[model samples]
Target: MRAFHNTVLRFAACIAMMLLASFVPAAALAQEKTSALMTPELLEKVRRANNECFACHSEEGVKKPPRADLDITKLRPLAHDPKVFNGSNHGLMECTQCHGQGYTEFPHAADARESISACEECHAAKVLRIEKQLDASVHATRVKDKFTCSTCHDPHVDLIASTLIDPRKIVAQDNQHCLDCHDSELEFAKFAPDDEQTSTKKKRPDIDKIHEWLPNTRVHWQAVRCVECHTPATKTLSHEIVNKEKAERQCLTCHSASSSLTTRLYRHLAKEEQERLGFANSVILASSYVLGATRHPWLDRLIVGAFAAMLLGLLIHGLARIVARIVRRKKNHG
Candidate 1:
């Protein structure tokens, strides 16, 4: 019996050694951390492919600039952190996924195949079949930014058990997920404290505390999904529309209005104000942002031309009226 037990113990030890050999070494894991940590080598290799994209883009550049503006030799680390995207998953994703061809190498960015450089590469089949049902939802549109797939979805820790797919579900889940990060804005910090060791977390901040800060939409937006009000069209990752339309719709929908367009011209952007909006609106008040818009010479010319045309027409009509009145008087006198 002792001889048999000794042989069994030796077999078990050999099996354990083989199992230990199969495990990933700490060094390999550290290398992955280097890549994910945004090390100089990785950043340089990625930046080398397309560096000359900042010629015409006002203040914005490739954080991913377009191919025409790209210059391969001038990539540099940004001095300031992008606020709207401060903690966003875009920080960890690969550049090549969005930037495309020779992006991995120092080649001309113009050679990028615009069509294929989209979410469709991985999700095209799953998305195409579904959007076919929804009449091509906004989710199907190709993205232009230089973020990778892992930006939103953490590739390192994908638990297949709770995979989300539906757009509405995805948005709702994402909104809740964002709240986990943005609780300070919501004043929910009292309840969801970050400490994991003590077991004592603060209570949920009163709805009143929340109400006092946002003041207006705190109650209503609490019930609605955050994404619904903050319709983000770009992958730039900042959603800051005040949902003036939503507030407008709520007023029109409930408070008795003749039409949904009851919102005055001042409430929304004018035709020329389109370019003035985007990620900047996320930080500042909407009204204040509109007030600070830069006026172009063409805009002044347009306004002057409109006034000139209106005055000219008015003068022509007045002259015609005076002539008709004199002719009528002459006829009566005759």
Candidate 2:
């Protein structure tokens, strides 16, 4: 019996060791990949170079330009928060790397502006994927040549949404990109001009009035991203922005057990939740309370058990009362 128990213990120990061995490599590989992307030494070098550029291109720097005659609007495009840039995915890159060595001068050369590298230059693979999706989008089809990557994404401050853990933060950032164009009349006119001279120009719709049909519009806006409805429901993090006419209008798209949010707004969290909690829609419960959707299997079981117990207690109480009443009647008769 002792020998048999010892053998079982050894087998369990081997299984535990194998599991630990498997996990260690995976964790190490992830760490290795992150370090390969940007080491501390490289990050420091990038920051130093970026700080020098920011000395002249930052908000305060842009206000007091080398040339007083320089239009603030022209300088505004160059202005960006240094702290925000450092926190972004592109934080490891130097300014001159994209803008060219011409910017090394006190006042950048006029020709240097033309040398600024396109987003496609560095992000070739990503751009290729986005281009395919963009080709099918309303922006590309309607605006044609006028619309580009920078139209929605401000490269200076843009962060990779998938890497972010917080769903609310991701929604806030992504929605802001949409609102920047849709909400502002000046920005809206850029793509959809309402000029009477150009009869072909698209008229801007009243954004708030259009969304009046949605219940608790403010809550919906805060909790979910615009892309949840605007983009294709079939794809995850799809760039294909659909027209208002084709946009999702059904409330059940989100307010259900199998919510479309699992594939859209909360996609980053959904996969993690599935791995951690064995529930994909668990992401929704963590972030926001979606009616008819936030149900957990264990929680539902507990609720049912409680209700059953309550009914059983009521039945017992009723039986005891009837028994006592019969005894009292018997005593009275005696």
Candidate 3:
């Protein structure tokens, strides 16, 4: 019985050893494959190849001379700064990722635009959401030539969202994107070459001049987002941007107890927190307030009534004093 037990233990040991040995080759194969694909030399070769493509597309590449008929502003559109491109969010991605498969060769195929990948290819959900909003935007409904994602954003030069976290800075950047086309004389000409309504010489409104009625116009623009005024009042931030003319511009729109800024600007704050920091609280916390955001309806009416009563009392007192003075003067003259 002891010898039989020893033999059974030896057999179990042998089985375990065989299983361990079987996994060794598989692990080695996976390591070998990973090393082959991700060697330092391979990475260097990729960097070199990418630089070659940038040479033509970037500022260092051949600068194309402006055609006799071509507008000067249009000429620089093709030129890029390689340093800027490499620093962008898509910097590490290969040129072929968007340019397409055959674009690696010189004098690339004539149909390269067909090969370029749509932004929706990778950002399906985000693109879909923005598309729905954009479709319903004033830009889409009013303009004959509707704007696309590329119209406002340059994929090659635009920075990642993670890098633009400051609310004030973000607003300024977004507003600048709008001004780029809307403010550009050349852009206007391109949009409507034949139409006299959109004359190339016509300049965009001066930000301060147009918004002079708003107190501290420049400061407000810098501190607050253009979308805060331009977009229709909504809780969710989206691409449904309205034209300047349709924007909610009434002082009461923001100053009233039901200010949109209360919800939109301070949206990160919890409902309880917003309530805790009522109208005066918002002013105390942020040095700003929308007049009605925290106002009590009864209190507001009481204050208005009190002010009116005081003014009426003063008017009656002044009239009585004036009559008394005049009567005295008439008696003395008589």
Best by TM-score: 2
Q: After superposition, how far is residue 125 of candidate 3 from its true place, in Å?
A: 1.6
Candidate 3: tens digits of C-alpha lDDT, residues 1-334? 8535543554453344334333433333221211233346754664577777766665545454322443335335566676666544454445665666447675567775666666766555788878878877866775537466777777666653324434454556667777776667667445433335764444545655677877877777766667778777765766788776777778776666556654665454324344432333353135343345556566667899999999999999999999999999999999
Candidate 3, residue 183: how far the Cα is off, in Å: 1.6
Q: For model 3, state the Cα shift of residue 262 in Å.
A: 6.9
The CA lDDT of each predicted structure is 0.38, 0.72, 0.59
On TM-score, the stronger of 1 and 3 is 3
Model 3, backbone clash pairs (residues 3+ apart or across chains), number: 4
* TM-score of each model, paired residue for residue: 0.25, 0.73, 0.57
Candidate 1 Cα misplacement greater than 4 A, ranges: 1-92, 105-107, 113-116, 136-218, 226-334
Model 3: CA > 4 A from native: 1-49, 62-75, 144-146, 160-162, 192-209, 251-334
Model 2, TM vs. native: 0.73
> Which should have the higher lDDT, number 2 or number 3?
2
lDDT sort, best first: 2, 3, 1
Which of the predicted structures, 2 or 3, would earn the higher TM-score when compared with the native?
A: 2
Q: What value of lDDT does candidate 1 attain over all alpha carbons?
A: 0.38
